[model samples]
Target: MKKTNLSFIKPLAFAIATVGLMAGCGSDDSNSSSSAATSTVVDSEDNQLAFDATAYTTVNISLDGVTMAVRQYRIVYVANPIEMASQSAFGSTMLLDDPYIYQTMIVSVAEASVSDENTALYFKVNNAGWFTSAVATDITEGAEFVSTSDTDAVGAALKAGYVFIDVGTRSRGARAVDGSWAGKAPAPVVDAKAAIRYLRLNDALMPGSAERIVVTGTSGGGGLTAAVSASGNSADYLPFLAAVGAAGVTGEDDSLASTINDDVFAAVAYCPINNLGNADAGYEWQYNGIRSDDNTGSLNGVAYSAGVQPAASAAIAALFPDYLNSLNLTLDDSSALTDATMNSAIVEQLKEELERQLAAGTDVPDYGEDFSVTLRGTTYAIANDWLTLSGSGTSATVADIDFEKFLKFVTTPIALKTVVAFDAVGVTGNPNISGETNLFGSDSYEYANFTQWSWNNNEVLGDGSGTDDTGLAWSDYLASTSELATQLKLINPIAYLNTDADSAPYWYVRHGMIDRDTAYAMQLTLYYAIKNDKSVRDVSFKMPYLTPHSGNYDVQEAFSWIKTKLDAGI
Candidate 1:
């Protein structure tokens, strides 16, 4: 609920306007801002970097019978472009999975001047299962065109002069022919930061201000979005940036090139499946005793085994309380998060979500009827009698929510993931081989244990038969226990909160209430951490009722939130 700094916006906007006017009037022809646009710099010994102000295609974007012309620029942001270029060699024969892995696209409304307060930058990094690279396509290929009677979020932003930048980055399975990992921990985030720096160094040629970039994504991409937002300008990324030969890797403080050192203005995350180090424990803590089965793969509603899984799950669940206590997170009133108040906080959040759904006139089955809601043509159902609504449509509030009953109704009948969800020790019969396992791997194909609990107790945690280690030994895991811990800290957003890193000032996080991908504890932890940070200007956290693990469900509303911030010049 932190308010935007209206007092700080006016002068900043005036200054930007004045700068733009001066640039347009040829008042500062010799200024570094003007010179940087046309100048070239050596990114490495072999490649030189420059931004062509005139190199772009004008595309007519039509949404809701309204069309707007925007210029789109597709540029390779890496220093050694040929290394990751199209059909480039990875491992002898394995070609580059995504041709545009090192590229970026900037779309902005056609304008006379480059600098404008109304034109903010939206940077999007794509990730699915942590292994699938973001598919980079031309906007002219009808990629941005979706049929809708009302304007969409991207369309609205474009019309309002917001520059949208889609960044293509390396993901979990990318590797070099030199037998080294190309896309591993720190690579994706490093690529994203490099893209930001590329835009900043070429800010004079771009239509939006580099200082007002907003990064957004969903699921694994959402996790990366949060990482990009949290670790901005931190010294931890210096080596990685230098390795990629990113633009403006070094510069004086507050200089044009120093904008690389600046942080994003805001961030938007939906169902961010991050914080992998604590994810397993958090997942088990919520759904440990809920399911009566031992099936690790599909949610068949058949109680498989009553032996080892329940014990291992309980063991993992027991670790969550201490982890929660260790974070020292605070509630809205600044009270510490502990075992004593966790359930109450969760119940309150659920009630809030239900209240908002009621006010929106969302349809729900009768209180005595089974709980069933369809999303994206898939009807998710559960036996129910726990929720009760008061008042009529648009005025209804959550009369009561049977916490235990609701928990059973949502998670039961369907298990989102296995006991050890994120850091699945793959050796056992349990197919814990998730994308996160590849994410923490040393290379593209190798999966490693990223959590201490899973690593130490892998023998018993896997198979759920209270048996011996039947597959690959835990000691032979790729990353050592300490190394995995370090990587986890590097990717976790909570680690950067209240730290010296220039974390994004504005944040909008949405986790669907019925999302079973990751535990609600993960988002709740991030929400509380951001809410407690004094440096953050504003943070809006919400869980839409009965929504799935998706992003931009309320596209119009999300864009409106971004528009309000842009109008405020923040």
Candidate 2:
């Protein structure tokens, strides 16, 4: 049934079985003497990616003042080493400056516990906004020791007997040839899959069990983590993996093999900017007919007036209700999750954050210092008129409150983006294409629209040119056989949640309450989709109060959650 504290049972049973078997072997057989276990180093056959298990360095890292020894291995997971070594992820959308970073992986494990076969694997994908690779040069170049104290949260994971794997994946701007963008749509996801295959193939030499792999990331990387979870062991990525010469893809007769799998046991995503195809509609659905007069915020270092289109916003908002109903999701009580139920769910989550904030005295915009909220130079004091409280100091709770006023007050005057948040329409030659636009682009086209509504109403919303700036027409891109259409499905995790993609059993999701980067509704939708999936065993989702668009803020808590899952025998 439900697993409880079974993580330790297997090791104990193995020990007892070994002891019994050794005792039963009489002294008559000299060869039956007990011997210590030794790890083996095996080289791969020709035409396959080889992992030199003996080639590694060890370092002493401080995990929040607790020192721990770790063995690190830097391996290139792809077969195209020459091309990968020459390419670099040079773009502003994510981290930059590293050759061979996009095709490499840095694996770390506790030196003392290298022989423990029960140790779990933790794969970390950095939250680099998807346009460039998030290179872990610190771990690779022994720079992890320079700022060990600050980044040792990962060391804590190692202290908990978990092997850490920092995966470097290619993003939008990376190119192998002169003009071809090699790091497009399926490249990042495919690279991650190849790394998984490498680990499985070399499991005999690895410190941790390859079966207990857990993947985690933040923001765009979080979205990729979710994608990895949903597309596990699916045939959609076979060709991509074969192209990279991943383990288990090269077969006897030169045909692809399906012997190894990339499915993870668990996943953790923090403040993920996902489901981008529906981002525009979800944004308007949450914030229709709401715009602030103050233009204090600047976009891309350029000042733009804060405004909203009433009719266009209304049309966009109207599309969300049908989309929600179409998913056929169900709630805890086995009730269908419709538009009305979804709104209630969001409100309930909001109320929970409010109660937690009030109890801790950390409610924004005053936070804890002044206990006041300032809006457009107008300051308001907290009182019992709109909110009723009980108890005090961690025990205090919101007894009653005005939901409408609370929603508006918390999210007011911060019109950070335009009505069409993801797909911003402008001139074809515009250099300031949004991240979503670049994500859907290819080698021939560097920017494109993912949604039909945004493409059709570009004039009314954007520069009023009425010309399609995507270089590809909306209808043609939406065709069933179009490459872009398949790319969109492959990138979106929500598309494969309830399908037969071998979804991860355990999920840990966290979104900041005040994050304005993506729509709160979109994050909530991700939560419900995972929760409703019959294949998923458990899910822990939360929106920390007063948090903005950030990730890895609650590292200790996240590790604790992961530790609990491992303890529960995931």
Candidate 3:
């Protein structure tokens, strides 16, 4: 065994202080300095441990075209990992543990840079081994990169001078939230764009020749990577260009298409989600069999509605009294409500009441606790009654309105009008609209429905005027080949290092494997979809049969593979 000198004394002291601070001032204090000091110490320790800190360089690139500013951290490298031990363990029949290690880095960005040219790379790892909190902390501290090395892939990347980026947005919390992913896209897309921007601006962030750039993720992150790649007009999506444009900041053009096709080379994605429109297709639903199950004209008797329910709305109204007392919004003057409608007047009154209470800035009720009552009531009613109420009638008007709301809530595309207009252009080629054919087909009720949904929503958002239905159709068009092909192309580049029959590139895919996740199936689909695409075949896909979803062996194997890739220049 290779014994490396380990130090527990300094970290132990910091840990003691952390505990003391947590006990003394509570963990949420914004001004806590001890944690910052400890972090600095850890950074120094990491620098001492690794002599070649200059192996990686950090850069900040802005995203253009949106109302927000975006940044990214890019880690560029060349090489592939060598295979290590592979065996069947954990839930996966294909478990692998690659011992090869690497360095880690991070690139953070803002939300505005999401687009085809400026893309971010979000990385997710398993719960153990490299995924360990200590390891993740070490990587972040050492590289000044935002990362969580809780899995084999991440650890391996870190050791190989690869920077790891956490995909979840800051708003969604650094860690995964427990509720349904109610937001449109996962947090990873934002982070991925940020990473790409970072890399484009700073080329000194990787070891060896910092030439080609690739983006990859696993599981959920993989899904996001696929989405980013698919959403692009160029070979690589430059999300930062849009961000920069939106920020009123002028600089060199760092469009993804320019960087990817011209500068940054290649992309990699693992277990990607190709069909967002059909995300629910094969998903298990007890009441509906599978979401893909066709039940034309059959009602599930579930009522759905938009916005808050009447009862919850009433409860929120009731809370006004208590809120008013807390906010001191009581009627000091009714002059502001003279020209407002009844409902509008009431709302204005409440707003004024709240403003008054806050203005004193003396004694205030707990906003969280005070708001919880209204929120709880509204949520309860909406959850229990909205579905039934919204879907109650069969009239075309009712159906149309309900569907419209559903579309608005589900797919809030950025440039709704442009997407719609783009789709309308496609309709000239296929004019038929009937329910009998597949919805995604050229002339089907599905197309018409989507078109109407898109148009109405576009009108609502007031951004552009185009056919919303067309965007959905376009997504379907790409789903057949482009999406899957892009994903396969990315993951294919990394060579499998572990020789164990159950290792990656093989284990996660080969039929009948117990540990195979949806990603494996997706890979297979993409493989068959574009087996003939020249741009795709150049990529490689390595598989092993003995890797489990948990444990140190798996982590070791993944790390080894990443190291191999970094070394081999694949």
Candidate 4:
């Protein structure tokens, strides 16, 4: 991203105050108490939110009739905690008289000695669609809602015996009761870090070991999971985090409550919606290969069928190889990955895992070479259209074909897929649609083309007929070469991998094979990135059969994996 010239603008006095807070939060600074009292950031009304000394407390609560001790507190994660805090359980309605709500954090923690291994923390968010984080009770209980289901992925973690912590971080659509951008980019992630610090700061009295916390989330929450896992305690986020009054500065040895580390021991991201900038190209590779004529067919190939205009699909397909090679991925054993090799390795290894699980009666389906298989009235195949099975019931052999031929054979496929880059459709149709478009858009702007494809189509390409396509006004800020460029780097786990900052020592990534909201390649790249890192070894991942854009298909399996990692103490 281009750096702006700040010479023209006048500095706010609040800026100086921020610096003083930073100084107080410095590694060697031990006067946090006085600094916190003297140096505070004020909001629009000149109101300063201070820390409440007794807000952190534990109580006994019963869920499902199981009585357990739960430690719950609301932290003013940022300096200008928003107004919503006033209405919360721990916040005071009196502004300036007590800490404000904008930057406040409500964290809930419970011990699971019988089910938990060591000190593990699973981060929970309500971002099933990566659009909203509204409180609900099930994955699909309400429209575009999640973290509501007690029987989903979250249940597995609870059953696995790990201390759980839920951070009340804000999201894109999160509006303060005062109608401010309280929760925005870097806000949720920043708040999450603060909550982690709070846990570590009180680890001695807390139920679990702070050293072994494991972060977990689904969809957009999973996206944040990747970001948080990769960018743990990075200096880049210090400005935003410190601004929010988060506890635990690196250098400061402060009041027992103030300074602590903010990284986790491991992370589990289920169907993480990430790698946005390049996700479209990967989606194009998967969808464009199917001939448009194949639409509405039984697709003797796979459970779901897909197709778009042949020329359009091919045009999109042409963009894939170059985009893929740019990843520069490699194997743990020092083997460089070419596009063909990586894709081949994905297919081959998946075939083996599928076959192994099937033979073990794990309900995972089986497949053969050529990326094609036949099971229970469905003849599933990918890669090249030349060898498609002619008769449905008889044995068949799919011969070698080109890459463009292999694609999802869906009955009724939508244009650009449900998970295209930046959401090409949701904007004009559903105003509140939860898509990647919402994820990338800032609080001030509800929509922006964060990808070159979106940029070219809506601004430059103009409907592909060589005419002006006024999808949205083009702005330099929204361009990938501008602020979005830097923000993308910040949010993308890939950018933070192999960095000096803390990376989760343990990882469990479970992606659904048929999930098109984003390509399998995004998750594949993440898995390989971590797998290739010498510092990480206990990472395990799987692409489940018949699963869609959701996760946690096999709880027992996930528990077993968690137990293995816990037993190994990685």
- Determine the backbone clash count of candidate 4: 32
List residue ranges in candidate 4 displaced over 4 A. Answer: 1-79, 83-118, 134-161, 176-184, 249-259, 291-319, 332-334, 362-406, 409-421, 425-434, 459-482
Model 3, span 1-570: residue lDDT tens: 111121101121221121100111112211101111121212211222111222323333211211322233322110111111221112232222211111113333332322222222224322111111111222332233212343444334433344345422211111112221111122233223333333332222222222334445444444444444333223222332232111111223342222221122233444443332222211111012111112111112322122212222232233223312332121224222111222233233223333433454422222122211112123211111101111112211111112222212112211111111112212222222211111122211112222222223322221222234334343453454352233222222121111111111211111111122222222433333222232332333333222212122234434444444444542
User: What are the runs in model 2 whose C-alpha is more than 4 Å off?
Assistant: 1-47, 64-67, 81-99, 137-152, 250-257, 295-312, 356-395, 401-404, 412-414, 425-431, 457-476
Ten contiguous residues minimizing lDDT sum, candidate 3: 126-135
Better of 2 and 3 by TM-score: 2
Residue pair clashes in candidate 2: none
Using Cα atoms with residue i matched to residue i, what is each candidate's TM-score against the true structure? 0.81, 0.79, 0.33, 0.67
- Write candidate 4's Cα lDDT for 356-406 as tens digits: 444455522113324444333556554333223222222222223232322
Q: Candidate 1: which stretches are off by over 4 Å?
A: 1-47, 66-68, 81-118, 142-151, 251-259, 294-307, 363-366, 380-383, 391-394, 412-414, 457-482
Query: In candidate 1, what are the lDDT values of residues 1-570, reduced to their tens digit?
Result: 111221111121221122111111121211112222333332331123345555666676564455556666666664533133222122233465534444444444544324563368878777765654543643553335443313255655555567777777776655444444456676678778877777666565557777788899899889988888987777666655655555655432232133245368899888998887788888888777665642244312323363355666787889899999998888877788876777778888988877777677776554776667666686866655788877777887777878767766766545557555777654223543453765664453345566655665555443321124324334454332344555677788888888888888889999988788888777888888888877788898888878778887777767778777766764
| Candidates in descending TM-score order | 1, 2, 4, 3
lDDT of 2 at 494: 91
Candidate 2 on 421-455: residue-level lDDT in tens? 77664422223655466565454555456676766
Candidate number achieving the greatest lDDT relative to the actual structure: 2
Candidate 3 residue-pair clash tally: 117
lDDT of 1 at 484: 51
Residue 513 shift from truth in candidate 3, angstroms: 3.3
Give the candidate number with the greatest TM-score: 1
